[model samples]
Target: MAPAIRVEIEKKHIDEAIERARTGVSKEESYYYGDRLTSGLQLRVQGRQAFWALKYYNFTKTIGYAYPAEDKHLPSVSAARKLAAACKDILDDDPKMLEPMLVKYYGGADRDVKKAKKEMVAVSTGWTVEETAEAMIAARTKPDTDDPIKKSTVAQFRLTLRRPQVKALSKKPIADVTKADLDAVKREMEKSPEGASMIKKFVSDIRSILTWGATHATDMTSLDPSNIWWELVKSGKKKRAITRSPIVDDIVKTLILAESYLERPLPGRFSEGKFGVGHNVLNALWWLALSAQRTTAGTRLRLVDFFPDPKRLGSGWYLAFWAEGETKNGKAFVLPVPPRAAGFLQERMAKAKRNGDSQWCFPSSQARGKIEIDIPVDRNSPGGVTERMAVRDYPTKDKIAKELAKNAKWESPYVDLLAENDIMYWSPHDVRRTIVEVLEEHGIPGGASAVLAHEVRLTDDLLFVDNARNREQYLELRVSRVTKLAYGAGGFIPLKSKAMEVWTNTLIDRYEELHSTYRQARKKAQAERVLKAIYSDANSAAEAKEAAYLELPKIRRKLEDNLTGHKQMLSGLLKKTPPPDAGVRTARIEIELAQADLDAFNTDPASYAIEPSRRAASRTHSAVLQSALKTDEKPVDLVVEAPAYTQLRDQFIADKIDVHTFRLLITERYPITLDMMDDRIITGMVTGDEAL
Candidate 1:
């Protein structure tokens, strides 16, 4: 060990020198030096500096230092004495002896240096590096404040004052903190349990402040206060987790029940004054909630975005709105009204029109002019006023969200209603989630990401190809598939079957009418043939009979002419006188010849003079009869006019035939098969001569 040394001071002199030191003299001339001399001991300075000098004797040794500058400069004598006593107590140790003198000298210009040195002594007695580390971690994990920094800053100011907390905390000394000191602070916080959280947060804030100072402060030698705190304290307890709101089925039921309340009548003044505005105000709120839109760049919607009616696009009305502000994305956005939303708008428009509010669909009652009220009424305002209105102002987006929070117990009322009913929700952006879900359920290709408008994850080939063209092709394929399912082959089954039934009945009726007409024509032709045959037979018989009659007349005339010529001969013979028997014999011979000629004409028309003409008429009648008989030949009738064989043959030639009955059979029982037919063929079936 080192040699022992001793020194002492006289009470009066020590006090006088202390007074001088308090008056701001240099430490060499202060009470501490006088104490060494007064002790009547040999003084050997271990260090040359006056403040750091050590006095020693054969018996003892001691270091001496002056009071701190701040304490020395104080006017109070008592305060100076107390500071001197503190300095004297510190002189026993190596660090203690130099620290106070250093603090006295540097404290005015460098208070942190003095404080750090003091804390170093405190940490040596009480804290460890491990404890400091723990405190730092706890600080980092602590909850942040509502306003961590100013809302906004100018560029120049941002550069100068950025991370101010970090700069401030980094300069703090950590060695001074003790574990007991940290525990005491925690105990105090627990004493007021309500403020415990706040205390913990303060500790955390301090730690973060120190960390920032370490990283950003101009001085690098200072201990990080945050690190010191961590070593002094364990991590604070974590906060309990909060539960999210449940999207229960009861919420859906509640909304449905509330829908009727939307249509309830307002308190009416009846014959005295106008109705209470509550009903209208509430109803409009409901409508606005139902019509939630993105109101951002992706889907910017305005008053003009709506079509009045879905069913009648051309006949229905439409609304257009001009937006004033930019969208959330910093880009302009415009949203089109889908069919269903348009229909809803149209119905509302008609109601408003009936109320004589034709000029404005949703007018602002407090607007300065017609142009000001051009947009849809803000839902939160009474009497359709805006937020800036002098009377009833509209609620802001935050206010609206707060109000909705009270009612938003379900996923979304609009989404539930629209999706469940098959009328897709197209307005609110979250409804897109519902849409994508539905598309996925249907197994439509590319539906999942497409509905969400996500970037496509494409193969190399697809990426090289034009995405737009591929998208079009994909859409067309989807359309074709849907069409196939809807139409079920020849045509849409439901409509096509009904149409075919009507067409078959009509064609059958027409066939019956035509058959009746054809039968009549056949009968007429048969009658004409019968008449010609009868006429031929009658003419042949008549011609033979007329020839016999004509033959008799011609024969009689010839006999009479012969008799007249023989009369002259007979007169000459009579004058010459002749026998009576001889005259009678000649007359009998002439009568027999005349009778023979008549018999020959009757036996055969060809034997007489008129026979040739009769034979020619008979031949002509026979030819006419044969020609009419041939013309009247009839085809064999069958039960079925168009046979299966003929139909099959026709089907091959035409690819398919509208076998009236066959089409009906296929439509009802084999609809799927019909769906497989080529689209071109199906189209041809519709335009062809076959029954529909």
Candidate 2:
């Protein structure tokens, strides 16, 4: 081989160099002449062939051919020097980018240059963006780094790639991803859901995968470095606000509505050990509202992650929790659980324990199938969740209010209730933001960063300015050692506790007000108005009183018809098994209310009546409707917990309106007997216009 030599890389010098390479070079690879204009630039010649080369960071790369006789597409002397100078600057920052640059601009037209890399996967036959992204995901599965990408981050990465514009472009290999294609993808993502605020983060994630691929040539050898990714990697960071700050009162009301939904009996179908994850969903929603943590923090939280802090502050023993090794900043989160929240924590602990789910604080409530064989037999056996909440049995807020309504087909109260609270829409993440904002307002400026599990000193350099790094002088501008020590576990507790207490108390006050409103509304309900006239009014028309009393049984019969089909279906289920625990509790209430409705029908309108509790009377409407839909298989000897309205029945029964045996006869779950009805009342019912 000819020896390397220095020369001005002009067209004249390049021509003279190739002629000498033909005579002096032996049967070897090549000979080179160095450039004075560019640091790593060289003109390499091998007999009849000559090309521009660069040796950046010790690795020699063929820039392109310089021999006109060999190839007409040769770059000019000045153009080759310009390309070399630009590439050398990029290499100074990241030397790993050299292989990708060659794959992109080899021969001045992105084709293989076997002189630099051992092999290359060209854009035409190589892995698409999707395929390379998958490779990146796999490599990160057990990544060997202090800070690794999270599974959720990978999930978002895949979702961004699936967007229409991005997905279409991803079908092409990374090397073929042009600037036009990337710009179009950027616009599409910016207009997407959560776009304006999250677009930068999404684009950065894509660039990360490309960087991973470019560095690891054995896995992915080819990609167009000229694509817009390099420009975007260090681009401007101006995050736009997408979600508005949550209205603090609306947050409180949302919690109130969620509690109200949970308090009601589960709708009939969901009540039984119906195969579902409903209870977990409802409980999870409440927990999320109270805690104000990320959805995953609450959803994936295990009972084990929360150990009570031994340092009990006042009467409350606060819990210190971390995000199960998945905090966004990779820092441990230590927030104080206020007194109200601690009470809620205890309540949830008791509930989870009752269901035999000690592991997950929010466990799946899925029940084994109570549904039986199609052959003629009772399909349902005694029903309840057979599996306890355990490891990885996380919670979600889907279908939260579906099982709360008496009528399952009706639109879930969850949606309408949120609307009533004047929250057209809000998410768990919105709640998280509101909590953070509250902390910021109450605490010192930038003091709330610790609540979000961020390192205050690292993320927010309070004492330092941006230009301070460019003009360094002093040892440091930071705070004292005592201040740093104070910023640890003990310092944050007071700030966290105050924020939590204010929010929790606000929510509790709102909830109590809502209950007061409910009481006022129930007093004026239509059923309440009719009952007062039928039993209490002293000087009403006899015909109006008889007519009002007559309407009760008619409403019962209509609702009872609605229950028939469900009862028949339920009987078939019970022949083999029993109802689910929730279904059983609710069904028992329905049966008692239906029996009470029968007793009210059989009683004669008294000359002097005792006033009944309006609350119990109003509850009767839902109970009657619920009972009609219950199954017929009865447990004769078993005494289940009774409904609230049963007290109203007891009030009338104690009045001795009829004989004790007479009361027992009418209340039994048998076909309604007309034997006790007065002839005049019966005739009045036969024809409403006729006299009582």
Give the whole-model CA lDDT for all candidates, comma-separated. 0.36, 0.50
Query: What tens-digit string does per-residue lDDT give for candidate 2 at 1-692?
Result: 66777777677877775666556555585678788767888888776667787897677777667664454344578767766775676567656665555554554444333333444232255678888888888777764542257677889889878877676877877666655666666777666676654567656767776777676643463764444355554314476666756666665555444444443532322453443334455456555666676566566454544444445636765564543244555544555667777676567556642234224565544422221211111111001111111111112123333343444444432223444346434555666677667666665434344455433222332322224354333213222221332246455766666666766665555555566564355433323322222222111222223444445555557556645645554565456565566665565566566655545645643311222222233333333323322334231110121222233333443444343443343334212222323222111111111111
Per-residue lDDT of 189-307 in model 1, one digit per residue for the tens?
Answer: 55554545544554554454345435444143255545544534553656644322212122222223233334342222133224323333333432332233232322223232333
Q: After superposition, how far is residue 79 of candidate 2 from its true place, in Å?
A: 54
Rate residue 114 of model 1 by lDDT. Answer: 38
Q: Looking at model 1, which ten-residue stretch has the lowest summed lDDT?
A: 455-464
Estimate the overall C-alpha local distance difference test score of candidate 1.
0.36
Q: What is the TM-score of each candidate against the true structure?
A: 0.21, 0.29
